[model samples]
Target: MAHFEKAKSIHDWLDQRLAIDKVNKVMQTEYWIPKNINFLWAMGMVLVITFMMLLVSGIFLLMYYQPNIATAFDSVNYTIMREVEFGWLWRHVHAVAASVVFLIIYIHMFTGIYYGSYKKGREMIWISGMLLFVAFSAEAFSGYMLPWGQMSYWAGMVITNLFSLGSLEMNGIVEWIRGDYVPAQAFLTRFFMLHVLLVPLAIMALIGIHFAALRIPHVNNQDGDEFDYDEESAKYLAGDTKGSKVIRFANDFLSKDLFVVAVYLIFFFYLVFWNYGFAMDPVNFDPADGLKTPAHIYPEWYFLWSYEILRPFSKDIGLMAFGFAQVIFVLLPFLDRSPNVAPANRRGPFAIWFWLMIVDLIALTAMGKLPPEGIFSTIGLYAAVTFIALWVALPFITMMEKKK
Candidate 1:
């Protein structure tokens, strides 16, 4: 009798304090989720989850890893070859997650472009995403140098050269960041902290803002409709709540989220287990020496297109050209001015231009990987020309559309 009364009293007290009615109303409210989002939409969620995996795995690795230039290389090898149980598994997971994160973000960015998700109200969201991309690239590059292999050493050298453009003039700044005449102890230590701490924190905060902004606007559908969005009239559909809100997170939507996450994990595991991690060249394991440069130093796969752009240009032009290419990617939202979000309605001129840009990127990536010989240089020139044409042509197509 005493126990029953206590339980009843607790239940009644909780019921009075909780807003069960408000919670129920939200769960029952129908959100305007885009039905045709497909696997690409899932990529953003996959990226967020994968970052979590990397963070967890990285923390474990750091427990045993050293960051000093003298020990950094050996520390990584020790973890993989001898130190902890399943240390190899942890290292491989971190590497694979890095690649997967980039792959997913790239697809997600294109999906945004295809849908024109960056237009009007969502421009800030797009900008934040672009920043995230830049941050992720820095994180990857820094982390790559930590393993202290031949590839890692020369890679550090090549990338550091980018900072040397006006080094003769900006000697103070360059030396401070490099901490020595070359990539040395301070560089490794700082990069280690950034790869594990600073970059990830910034990424998380930006991602939070990204999602908050997204939720405010709600998702744009295939038909370019949010809750009140109207396509034919090019107006808000009207008669919906003004501010953003979420219903119960425990309904049908939760199930779909779980399903998508599960599918991605399965794919991740297949790569992790079957493929193993990509092996650094045995030569890269050696310490950095400015006297000995590697025969060919390539940036990671994701940077290949930009690296390719620099390949064919003369030394004087390469860096400038690559820098210009990056500007275009950063300013893509402004460059594309389709009034409607969907590309399906975009005319032949716009459609054709988009495809041309895609092809140019592919060509550039291929050229970046190839030796700087006759065929590769020829291909790079063609790709560079085509890339410029496509970029300039798109705005022209839009202009013509306006006149029509």
Candidate 2:
């Protein structure tokens, strides 16, 4: 009873000050969530935590990083890595954390795709996420140029020139983006501003909206089955009953989310400490030199799948294709006409096509690393075709599929 009184006093204090209980009760989350969701549900929270890590580490990195082209590379290699206290650790964390963040984000996306998490009533959640991906890609690309290395310079040129292919105004836009005729100190400064300031703000805003939208839909689960929340809230508002089978967010997910976060952090920091530069482009270590280019250039591995898609066409046409590719993914909720939420509910080519697309993507990512010539380019072209074909054909294929 003494302990109960103490807890009651604390609760009363918080309630009076913040209306804590009122918000929780109004949100319809008594900390409960759908019990059917597995470990995959934790991925979003992991992404949130990783973003926070990047922000903190990035702030420190900015303190030492000189955005000027002349000193950029040396500042990182010497000042950050060798001179500043714990600067090496922070630098590695920033560089390595970017890769880890992207890795998990890809998994989080695929995990959603596999479970049909975007189906009905949750379209906005998926759209917000997809838009977040767009913002994220732009953020990563801009940040990549900050190092001002050979890979950064060449990759920036290759990517930014894609914007140069349109009308006269489009070319002007390219110049505006670069801040010069070519990628130079001015370009780096502009990129630094976007990478460190504008983009992060955009991402934070999107994240807030994403969570707001998510709470409305309540959340999706692995079963793809309807939640039967009437069991718990039968006496409550009928409006809240529309999306049921829910549990309180704090109850079902908290422990599991924490456990996964712990594991993820361990693996993340392990990479930061032990294998900091794994899978990074070796050519990027060299200072940028426009006079001589690396024999072959490629993006970070997460982007390789899309890069392969870009390889088969001319600059203008490929830019069109890539543009479509970026937006179409988030539009999946509308694009797919199938009524069945779970892939298993349909016993037909939908599942086959789904796995095929996954395989095709994996193949394309692998092929991206190989030289885009001879037999390899041919294979990449075929793989890209297959990948696009599956997505394009999903609605019709699902229509023909037999429902269980």
Candidate 3:
């Protein structure tokens, strides 16, 4: 055994053993962030807060949630909402956070694209972020099934059936996924396992990877200026803080993040207390009945854009388009051939391309919610085609951008 010195205090003792001070220095105190960033940079913190809310509320809700199909509906609708004390509040927070998290994620993603944050050296940040997106999507889908409501059941059914691969007839994959021919006991149990355990763990791991990726590349700023971080950070550390172009991540940058998070919490609670109906589908109020199908079955709004891509074409073609939409975004760092790393407005045709893509996706989302008929069908088809065409055009349009 090694000789030991008497500890100064609990923190000192722990720091000596665990290197808490070093961790703080690395992850917080010494971590330098560019001062040129705006509130959009705070979305990562907001996402963490929202995910914490989801996890806490989910744990409380899970305490009373019954996985069995026969009791799952009543456990949520009656027992948790009406019987448990303040369970309704937890449910509302969860429902609103689940929806709002995606809103924040979209804003974060677009902000990244707009600022060219995904360009050059920060590919892992983008890729890890996309992986987090995929993990969260899976978590949401699995959680949606836990309610055992009409829309939940049918949405699960419809989404799972896609695994059948159209004419390829690989429905064994579907049944294997569902753990039965239908969304019954085994299906519910499997999804409950995923929602409550597996996917959340995956999300947490991906969040770690995402943050780690950010540490090396640092964060891209609004101006996309490639300043010397080491030099600026030295200035900050050496007491020229006001003159430095960077700030410590601990008190300086975190203060800004907290301000944005506070504002977001205000908006979030407003939804939870009053406007949460948007997050909870009205159709989900009904208990799942395999015999009854809603006249119009649609996914939650966040998924609408991609769903519309799959809606307009023939089955095989639709699947292809949908797959393209899903995978194309992950390939964005490679797709944009421009050497420049600046806001879209500064980049010639790329600016138009960015705005058009945004508008097209918005159009696709709107059409996805409406019944596919008459003018809606025609518009969705055009929008779907435009979406794929835009991605195909990205490399060529960006290649023409003059070096800046």
Instruction: Give TM-scores for every candidate, taking all chains together and pairing residue i with residue i.
Output: 0.84, 0.90, 0.98
Name the regions of candidate 1 deviating beyond 4 angstroms.
1-32, 166-171, 226-250, 277-290, 344-346, 402-404
**Top lDDT prediction, candidate number:** 3
lDDT of 3 by residue, 88-138 (tens): 999999999999999999999999999999978999999999999999899
Question: CA lDDT of 321 in candidate 1?
Answer: 74
| Model 3 TM-score on a 0 to 1 scale | 0.98
Better of 2 and 3 by lDDT: 3
Q: Which lDDT values do the candidates have, in the order given?
A: 0.71, 0.80, 0.93
What C-alpha lDDT does candidate 1 achieve relative to the native structure?
Answer: 0.71
Q: In model 3, what is the error at residue 133, expressed in angstroms?
A: 0.7
In candidate 3, stretches whose alpha carbon ends up further than 4 angstroms from where it belongs are 1-3
Candidate ranking under lDDT, highest first, comes to 3, 2, 1
C-alpha displacement of 73 in model 1, angstroms? 1.3
- Ranked by TM-score from best down, the candidates are 3, 2, 1
Q: How much does each candidate deviate from the true structure in C-alpha RMSD?
A: 5.8, 4.9, 1.1
Query: How well is each residue in 183-302 modelled by candidate 2, as lDDT tens digits?
Result: 998899989999999999999999998888877566667767775555645522344544455555664467788899999989988888787776356888999998988999989988
